[model samples]
Target chain A: MNDRKTTQDWMKDWQALQRQYWTAWADATRGASGEAPDPATPWHEGLEQWARLFGDASKQSETAERLLATAKNYVALMQSMLAAATGKAAGDAAAPAWTEALRNGLNLPGLDAALHDNPLARMLRELRGPGAQAIDQLSASFAPFLARAREEGLAWLGAPALGYTREHQEHYQKMAAALLDYQDAVNRYNALVLKASRRSFEIFEDKLAERDEPGRRIETLRALYDLWVDAAEEAYAEVALSAEFRKVYGNVVNAQMRVRSQIQQEVERIGVDLGMPTRSELNSVHQRLHELRRTLRRRDDDALVELRRELERLRTEVEALRRRPAQAKPAAARSAARKAVKTGNARK
Target chain B: MGPIHIDPQRAVAELTTFNQKLAAGLKTLRSLDEVDYGATPREAIYREDKLVLYRFRGETSPTAKTPLLIVYALVNRPYMVDLQHDRSLVRNLLARGEDVYLIDWGYPDLSDRYLTLDDYINGYIRRCVEAVAKRCNVEKINLLGICQGGAFSLCYASIHPQTIRNLITMVTPVDFHTPDNMLSHWTRGMDVDLFVDTLGNVPADLMNWCYLTLKPVRLFQQKYVGLVDILDNKEEVENFLRMEKWIFDSPDQAGEAFRQFIKDFYQANKLVNGGLRIGESEVNLRNITMPVLNIFAEQDHLVPPSASRPLQQHIGTQDYTELAFKGGHIGIYVSGRAQREVPAAIHDWLAAR
Candidate 1:
């Protein structure tokens, strides 16, 4: 009990010293350059004047209200300091004692009159003749009640302030760092997805020849088709869900869909004969021959000779195909015939 | 020869036959493989190792004091100006007794990738102009530039005003800030450096793709579909093929020159601001004191009227006239409607001067 009393006394002396230092600082900053200090001009009066000159009406009224609240707080702080110094219970002090002292010692009635005389209040009075007086009276009456409430409010909140500061700061820092890390991870994932999507198509193209069997080729083609469709869906999901990537990457997805559609249609049209040569294929071969002839003209003797032989072979094959009856033949039988003819011609 | 009197009906038939034969001859010539740069043509007039200037003489003895020099854009072969007997701007000018000279910008090869503005302006253009002057034995020549070549000619005329007596620009963009021009906006945002670095010279195929994309729906669908209506007419079919050939036969632009053009003209808007520099000399619009004729198509999507309007105000020339025609960019040269109005207007304007 004695130790508690001693701690209270120390707090009282510290608060008094703090008040004196703040009052002196405010005076030095807000001093008149050459005029003598007038006892008639209270500190609040100077504060009101500065607020009127340097601040607008709406803001100045708010400042005035804030200043009144601070004055009430100062009175409560003094009471607490006194309680600490005297080793007296806070509740034992007279009810409304600090409020009454603050009202009388600070010249509250005169200050209230000064606040009404302010430009903003004057304008309100002109705007609403007798209503302004009623408002002023009501506000003056409520000021003490508000100050007491503020004092009690600060006492209630003071216990948790230090704990909240450390806990909230650390939690916020961790959350912020985690959010940044998540963003980096998402970016890397998007890049990998894009690269993997591109490589998937390349892999499909490379493995196309590995599936030489008809059934295997069909299965492989279907898989390739599914891969394209799956890639497009994945790109859409990744790009659409991401806020930063949606706009820039949307066109790439659209282009991929278009190219995929074209490939699908072309693959469907090519169908079972994807590996076999057709009439148009032979025409393309002939077209290449013609192109070579046009390009080389009389020059390139070896190329010309090779092109002439190819042209004669193409002509003979086309004639044979035309002469053949319009009857179905087995693909195996045709292949065997082609092999035998090729070997015989080579031997000859 | 004196005007030969003949029956009106007979004259019409003969003229029609003559036109058909002329068109056939032009078609045959156009079908032949295009002459490569530095390759000798079967027939030639003025030939340098790097460049060639073709002169087609007029039927009438040349009487106009000022010779007209047609500068075609490097994007295409200059044969669009001499497409056929009916649609040929060169033949029309020759018929009007104006001495004509065309600048043929031959196809640039891989070695020509580093060719700079100095090489074009000082070497090819200057030599061509000097040749025209030397051939005419005249101090000044009238310049008519078409499309991109129009812009080049404007810069050339501004830098060398004494050589050009009168300047005519058709469907040329000077102010690139027009909001309606989609091509300008698309190109303004392009990564030109990345594109140029990857491809030594911008491939004509890629350039063609970009142009086609501007109006994909129209170029890919409506154009070919509309051809069905004209397939019955042999004349129309031939004309269609000729135009198609011209449209697709794009030449690759020199890489460095294209880079500078896009940077200096489209993005910076330096040409109109008098901040354009070709080699050591600055191109000043104030230096262009010659009479100017600014022709633009009212319906041109590539080079809108706004792109060509600011030229009249910026140039120091006192005598300036603007002729806005109802057509697209290519229509200014080849459209049947423009053939009568545009060419006649140009002839009258040239004759009056």
Candidate 2:
């Protein structure tokens, strides 16, 4: 990614750019003097005063310089990653020896060497280990319900009076399959999650065992953090990207929705039998009322806006009149004119 | 074990440092006055439902003829741009002499469950834009959108290209089907209707959990650890806590909008594939012929750079400029680099345009 530009070349260019930025910033601020500052706004004026008092110019300069240096470091890190990733550096200045050496063995975010050494991730794994079992137990408890739902759905659909047609049979079969599919999908998703977690633990445990003699598994917080991020991103990406996960997820949701629809239909059917309004009727009413409310809201808002505009215009006019020069010849009759205007038309 | 390869003294020192940091953190938290943010002086221009349109009163008179209207995402508070006194995007723009206006999409509840993308883009955002323009007495306005708000802006701009003079999208996801787009990936197969129906308005906690688990180890764990490292520095600690507050303070999404977005954008990739419709209006990216500035985070996990990078290719705007920021999703807004680089770049670009 770096096109083999050494750290020194990159930092020098970066510093030059930083100097340019400061220069431009200074020039721009200097230019601001030509434009009049608005002090009528208290908060903005306060901010300006506060900034001036705090010597924001000097502080901002210092901040800019520091941030540039940080940016330079970031550039260097990205370069290092690139060099490490490509496994080939045409130039002599490569990533630091340790990073480069570590690069060859690391697959990262999935099966990375660092995943084994991440202490915090390991600790979290240990903490969540028991939760895995709880999920399994919960899934087991939920199974019977799903099975019963599947059976009842199939039996209901297969009833001779409802339909002896081929379409009915197909529908029943599909419903039964979907019900089972929902459970299977949930189990699969859970298993994938478990598998990912297991992978991390296995790597972490094995490393811990191997490095038991060294007792130096985790070198630094940064290292541990890098490892943990990789492990997490990898595990998540694996389960998330897999077709099985995607299909199963869709299946589970579709089945759930289908089941809910069925229940709602049944409820509506019951409601019709009892001569009562169903959810559909209520929903239609809600839709109409919602539309009406929205329309009223829009009209009210427009009216209010117009009123506000008119009020503002009147206020502006009043202010303009207050600042106007005193009237000349007609001023002699001003009192009479005002009284006449307030009451009725003045006599010719 | 060979004289304990790891030095016990080092571990002791680490523990001691941790304790010191914890004590300092507690003291800092106690001393903190109310952390008031969105510090730039602003006046409420318009309000509809929970959405508020605010116009910032800058220190200097606006240099631009047209006002810049910021459309923030619905999922979070819009105060992120105007986050703090020094670290405010609004403040910097205001300082730059740009007339800045932002749409604050307040926390949506169950009442807003029926709010579709059409209502957001066509109704709320459209009305907000019109208000800004009318208030400024301008024919058109500069539009700046952040993340999901950017997407909305794109839709709005496409639908009513006449209203937008210049368009700027920051960390906005355009191509939802990009390989690195994890959110899209997870939602790709989701039964959106079922999901939305089941939870009238998707719970903030569940959504937050999904976001957190994106990089479970880093965002959920490593971030707090990093906070601990900076605990001794009271200012840093405060900043950390402020960000922490912002991170968790997410609003439940309007169900209809979320459903449509996930299904059409994520699942079907209709936005890129040319079948995205908001209400009765068809969203044609080709309709957006305005000068476009697309800024994205290089390290943005939420909306990956690749996801945002494809806009130039899809949009009909010949005057397209892609400014790739070297920071993560949030960092692009609040980072030190963002403070100096992003606002200045935007101001200069807008000024030139």
Candidate 3:
């Protein structure tokens, strides 16, 4: 578990490191708060705010660890269940056929080894590896910038101005705090997904096992195929309906958006320095065009409404003239009759 | 001893047939230059910003006074309703001697990315209804909304109830946040703004991926495995290709509209909750006072019957009728049962109304 090379081991190490970071950060905050540089300006606000973010990150890391552990256990359970069923028929054709079917279903390597070890775990390991790798890359990229900021922040607490005026210092600290919070939310989301996916497959297996009764037994390959679909939908329905899924889903996405927004802000700041138009400017234009189009539509609607009214009025006048000359009905009377006929026909 | 029983002869027979058919199917696939559809004769009577409104002329003439307009969802092309002559809902409606019109919300592009839901429901649909009414010389036209189009039609009827004599919603989700709503669940937390901004118009490939992943083993794997049975039948192969084309022929969703749809409908669940607004007009379900024909597929994974069932409690229409279509979402439009039951039900309902 202490090793940081394998997926689970590395994730566990990351969580522990985050906890240590949070502890160190919190200690700094407490040290800052215990002393006052001048009383006129509170130096601890910036430090303490960032400290809370680190604390949130630590909490999220712990939560994700718990969920991931649950997921790992679930994977182990599925491996055991699958092994129990397949191991009985191992020496026969049925076992080999089932293995072939499973291998095809998984479409992943290490199948032979996975059968002996844990197929579900191997599958999950491969599934999560790429995403984990990408996240690690991004985290590494952000590390240097964060390290510099941390140094600047700690020194500024003891140095002149404490980074800036009260408002600016607070805003910067709050933003840093948010960055940590976002990362935590992402971790929580990732962990939740791992657990949810493992749970989903387990549910599928459970339902498939249930269909082993006499009358409802899966008799054919087609039946097994159908069972897979039924089981998947059933599993999806369960996870989809759960309150935890919804909460974590929202948390993860919102956090990702927040992190993206911060990155976009930095990009915009750099763009502004280079005299380039940012997304905000384009958005403003889009907003204006949207409003203008709506206005044009409203104008068109009004004109159409007015035209209809004018048409009706002209028809009324024409009908009046025709009535004076011949036995033609008045426009009002004719329109009324038409409506009556329409409603009457509908009623039929 | 083995855990299960097997019929070796039956298995061998099936496998042999499957292999032979699969070979024939490849040749048939190569021979198929194009699987053309929309067999029913129609003329584009109106065109607005890539959307063309076609008025269908059926074999039989003028049984129903009001023309029926089919409004299909933007998620996919409308040709699913008119897939082919035998499987076509449009043809079926036509054969029933009903005047029919269809609004083809054509493939949206970069220029159309600015088009919002307001532009779709209020602007495009409203104008199309008016055009159909004028063309038929009637005060109102009958509207049939399929899936998301049904949702749009609901919004339209709410806004201008007078323009639609009858409103039919097929496999439409009225309640967005239902417990079994997988689509809503997945989209509830999505960063729609970022997604839209990044993609401009949502890519069809991505949209297809999202849908296909819902039941990956079934949609992608099992279905292909089952395909072996019908692979030798050229007709069946053609039918399958036509459907496969339609399934993959998803148009890019307009960016602004996609943004609003995901945020307002999927994320907020505003339509069912009485706070949905397209442009400026609030979509109050109470305003849907016209006769409503609500049809839902029994086993639709996309829009569960529970999602459509809430419309019974919400609408102001006392003249509401519900039909339980015994199929999935796609099957309700093309299955043989649908060919017989659906259009007939619609024809009879419209005639009575």
Question: Each prediction's DockQ?
Answer: 0.00, 0.07, 0.07
Model 3 stretches astray by more than 4 angstroms: A1-219, A251-290, A310-348, B1-3, B7-24, B191-199
Per-model TM against the reference: 0.47, 0.65, 0.69
Comparing 2 and 3 by TM-score, which wins?
Answer: 3
What is the alpha-carbon lDDT for the whole of candidate 2? 0.66
lDDT of 2 by residue, A1-348 (tens): 245767676555444433433333333334332332332221112223223433434412322222232222222323233233233222222223323323322322343343343433332332342323343354457568656766676465445434556654565455445456556765565566656654554443344344334445443324433453465556656666677767765665565556445445556767998999876776557557667877886798789989999999999998887775466346757977889887766453
Question: Which model, 1 or 3, shows the larger lDDT?
Answer: 3
Candidate 3 clash pair list: none
The candidate maximizing DockQ is 3
Candidate 1 chain B least-lDDT 10 residues: B1-10
Ranking by TM-score: 3, 2, 1
Per-candidate alpha-carbon RMSD to the true structure: 38.1, 18.1, 18.7
Least lDDT summed over 10 consecutive residues: which range in candidate 1 chain A? A116-125
TM-score attained by chain A of model 1: 0.18
The lDDT, on a scale of 0 to 1, for candidate 3 is: 0.68
Candidate 3 per-residue lDDT over residues B57-117, each given as its tens digit? 7887868888899999999999898888899898988888888899999898766778889
The models' CA-based lDDT, in order, is 0.56, 0.66, 0.68
Report the lDDT of model 2 for residue A157. 41
For model 1 the TM-score comes to 0.47
Q: Worst ten-residue run, lDDT, model 3 chain B?
A: B3-12
